[model samples]
Target: VISSFKIADIGTVDLDTIGTVEAGGMTVEVIDPVADYAELMESLFDFDALRALFKSGFRMRFDAMHAVTGPYAKEILENRLGAPNGTARNFIPLPDFGGHHPDPNLVHAKHLYDEMMGPDAPDFGAASDGDGDRNLIIGKGIFVTPSDSVAMLAANAHLAPGYKAGLKGIARSMPTSGAADRVAEKLGIGIYETPTGWKFFGNLLDADMATICGEESAGTGSNHVREKDGLWAVLLWLNILAARGESAKQIVTEHWAAYGRNYYSRHDYEEVETD
Candidate 1:
C-alpha cells in the first residue's frame, strides 16, 4: 500500500490573466494534482499507509540514482524512518552532470564501492537499482551477502537502538540461506518462509507478525516499510554493529561459528533468448 509522487515538468507559468504587477522574473512552475484522475490517480503520496511508518519511528537514508521516485521515497522514509531533517541525499546525476545507472552491484556501483572501501567510508553504505526496490549492503570493508546480511540483522536486531523495543519475529525468502533460520531458532522466535519476492514479506510485516524480512536478491526490510528497503537495511547493520562493539567481519565469523557455516553461491544467466 506504499504510495509515491513525482514533480513532473517544471517551467514558468503565464499568469497574465491574474493581473500581477509588471515586474517580471524567472518563475518556476511545477505540475502536481490535488485530485485523483484516471491518468494520475492522485499520486501515491496522497495515501494514508505512510502514516503507519511515522507512528513506528522508522527513519531512512538512501542512495538515490536519478529516478523519478527518489524524492517521494525519501519523504516517506524520513517521515516514517525517523530521519532527522536535512540528512538525506539524492545522489543522482553524478559529478559530471551526467546520469549514472543505479544498480546495486559491485561493478555497477563504482562510486558507492569506492566510498565504502575508502578511508572515510561511512560505517555502512547501501544502494539500489533504477526503481529503488533492490539493495546492496556494505559494512566497513566487508560486503555482506544479502542472505547472510539479513540473517545477521535478525540475529542482532535487539542490539539496534531503534529495535531495542524488541523484534517480534523474522522471515526470509525460501531461497535465502538458512542463517536467519538459525538465528530465529536460537532466539526462540518464529520464522516464516515465503516465495522469492518482497510482496510475500509485505503481508507478514503488515500484520505485525514479523520485525524483519529479506530476500536472496539483497532486498531487506522490517515493520518500518511495506516494501523492500535498501538504505534502511544499511542503517540497521550499522546500528547493530555499533551496539555490539564488534566489526562486521567479527560478527559474521562469530555467527558462522555458532550456527555452522552455510556457504552460498549463485549462477546468473545473461543475454539469452527464450527457446
Candidate 2:
C-alpha cells in the first residue's frame, strides 16, 4: 500500500487507524479534505489520552475565527491535541475572515467571548464556523447553549472513544431545545425531530435510526461523517473532559443537576427592506 504509506520513521504512531500517515520518508500527505479531516482526527480521537489528560493542569482554547478551521485548528489542536503554543486562536486562514465575522456567535466570537470570560481563562473554550460546520462552546465562565450543546454532547457520549459503543438513537432539529429530548429520555433511545437542513438528518443517519444529531444552529453530529462535525464537536468535548476528571464548569453543573433545564429563544430579521 505504497510501501505501507512509506515513512522512514520518526516517533511513528497510529493508534487506531483512519487512513494516510507516513513520516519523514514521505506519504503522510492527503493534502486536502482538511488534511483528510485531520486524518479522521487521528483515527477518531484519543490524542494519546488527550495528551495524557493534558499533561499537568490543563488549559485549552480554540478560536479559529480567521475562518476555515484555521488550518484545522492548528493541525488538530496544537499539533495533535496537546493544545498549547498560543492555543490556536485566530490561527489564520483568512479569506475575508480577516475581516472577522466567522460567526461562532456570542456576538461574532467577541474575541472568543472576551477570552472566555477572562481571569486568565482557558480550562476550555471553543469556536468554529465559516465552514468548519459551526460550534461554540466555552467553559471557564461557561456559555454552552446550542441547545445545551446537544445535551452536553449526548450526555458525555460515554466519555468518547468514538462514542464508546453507545448512542444508537437521538436526533434533533425542530428548534433543538428540549436538551436532546432529555438525552433521549435518559438513553432509552430513539428520539428524532428533524426539519432544519442536515438533509433532515439523512434518514436518521441511514436507518441506524440515529447516532446523535443536532442543531440550534451551533450544530452537533454523528453517524461519524454525514456532516455537522465542527471538529467533531470539539473532540466530543475533549472526550468528555478526559473521561470525566470534570470541569466544563463541572460538566454543566452536573448536567443541570441531572436533567432539569431546557430554555429556548430566538428571533432575527437582519436587514429587511421591503417597503
Candidate 3:
C-alpha cells in the first residue's frame, strides 16, 4: 500500500507531557518509483499496439500542470512509449504548481483545452491533477466529461491487453451519470452504485465484484490498483484508440449512436449561509 506524510501538518507538542527516548539515527530507503510505475503501466497494454499508434504519426500532448505526476508522465508517455520529447508539457513538479491550481478541469487546465481545440491540435490531450489520482481527457475538438469517460472506458475495455478477458463488473459513485449502466446491462455484468468516495468501491474491487470503478470527479481506475490512477486511465484510452483505429470524436459519436446518449449536469453552492 502507498502512503504519504506531510511534515507541514505536524503540530507543536509539549515535551513535558511525554517521555522522550534516545535512539539511534533512522535509515531511509529510496526506490526507483518512476521506473516501477512505468513498468506497471506498460504491463497493462500491448507494447506493439501502442507503438503502432505512435508510428502512424499519432501526436499526443500531456499537460502535467506542474504536479506530482509530471515525472511519471514524462517517463511513461515520452521515454517509454516513444512519444515526442515535448509530448508532455509542464513535465516538472513545482512546489507551488507554477502559481496555478493543479486541478484537471476546463477551468484549471484551460491552456491545454485551448491547444487541443486549436488548429494544430494534437491527436490526443490529457491532464492530471495534483497527487496524480484524477485525470481530464480531451480529444482534438472534444472534451470528454468524467461520466462519459468512465462509460466509454467500460464499453471498450476489452481492447486493452489487461482487460482482454473482459471486466467482471463496473462501479460508479452515486453522483456519476448512468451511462455505464447501459454498458453493464449489455455486457451482462454487475453494476454497483455507491456513495461518493473512493473507499466505497474498495470492497467491490477486493472481492472481484468490480473490475472498473470511477467517480464523477475526474477519477477512474480498475482492479489494477486500489486507488484511482490518472495515468492508467490515459493509457487505457490510448489502448482503446490504438486498437479501434478511430479518432476520439468518431469513437464518442459511435458510442452515443450505439448506447444512446445520457444527459447529466451537476450544481454546487459554495459558502452558503445556514438558512
Candidate 4:
C-alpha cells in the first residue's frame, strides 16, 4: 500500500487512513482496522516458535524498500517476533517509497543484493513488495530464484506447526517452473496448475483441493488466507531453517542437488502491430 504520492506534494493524511499505529509510550487508536489485522496475525502465526528462532546468533534482515510495509515489518519482525531492533531496514512509512520501485527483485533491490554478496552479510536476507504480498529471499552468497523458492518452501512447510499436518495438495501457475511438481509427486499429493492470476486458484482453495498456491511472479500463500503473503513466506523460511538448523545456502544447494535445478527467466519484448 505504499502510495506513489509524496507527502510534500499532498498534505499529510489523517491517522484514520493508516488503520492503527503504535508510537512511543502512548498508543494511538485510529480507525482500528489495522489493530484487528495485528490481532489476526497473532492468532494465525506461531509467535512462540518465531520468538525462539530469533534468539541468539540467528541474524537476518528484512528490507522494506521504503514502503508502507516498513512499519508493519518492524513491528512484527522486531518487536513481536524478537528479531532485534535493526532486523528491518528502510522502515519508515513513506508514500513514494523514496523513489524506489518496491518490487523485491534483484534489479530494484540491488543494494540489498550487494549487501548479501558482501562479507558482512547476515545469515539470511529478505524483501517484501509495497503491497506486502510478494517476497524475495536470499541467504549469504545465494540468491534463491522465485521458482526454486516456492518449491523449497513447499518441501519444508511441514516443519512449521501451522503446516505440520501437511498440505493436502499444492497449486502453481502454468508458466511457473516444474520444481514444485517434483515435490508433489514425491509426496503423493495432488498438484493443480492454473493460468495466471491468483483468482484462478480461488476455487481450488475454497474446495480444499489445494492447501497452498504460488506463482513465478513471487507470489505464495496457503488456505490460511487467500492472498500471497510476504511475511508469511519469510516466517515459513525462518521456521524451516530453525527446524533444520542449516543455513539457507546449505538447504537450497541440497534441494537443487536432490531434485535438480530448474532455471528459467522472464523477458519483455516490444513489438510492432501485426497486419
User: lDDT tens string, model 3, 1-275?
Assistant: 65975444334434443344333342233457788888888788876888778888999999899998999988877777788899898979999999988989888888899999999999999999989999999999998989999999999999988898999999999999999999999999999999988998999999999999998898999999878999899999999999999989898999999999888765645469979
lDDT of 1 by residue, 131-178 (tens): 556777766677778899888888877765557666788989998888
**TM-score of each model, paired residue for residue:** 0.64, 0.29, 0.87, 0.83
The TM-score, computed over Cα atoms with residue i paired to residue i, of candidate 2 is 0.29
Task: Check candidate 1 and list the clashing pairs.
Answer: 4-44, 58-80, 58-81, 58-82, 59-81, 59-82
Tens digit of per-residue lDDT, candidate 2, span 1-275: 45556435467556456567877656663436656888877676677878887675588878878877788888877777666788888878877988867878787787777887888987888888888887888888878888888888887787666777788888888877877787888888888898888988978898888887888888778887877877688878887888788888889988988998776766555569979
Choose 1 or 4, whichever is better by lDDT: 4
Which order, best to worst by TM-score? 3, 4, 1, 2
Between prediction 3 and prediction 4, the one with superior TM-score is 3
TM-score of 1: 0.64
lDDT of each: 0.64, 0.80, 0.89, 0.83
Off by over 4 Å in 2: 1-80, 84-87, 90-102, 105-126, 129-159, 174-189, 194-213, 221-232, 237-275
Candidate 3 residue pairs in backbone clash: none
Where does candidate 3 stray beyond 4 Å?
Answer: 1-29, 267-275
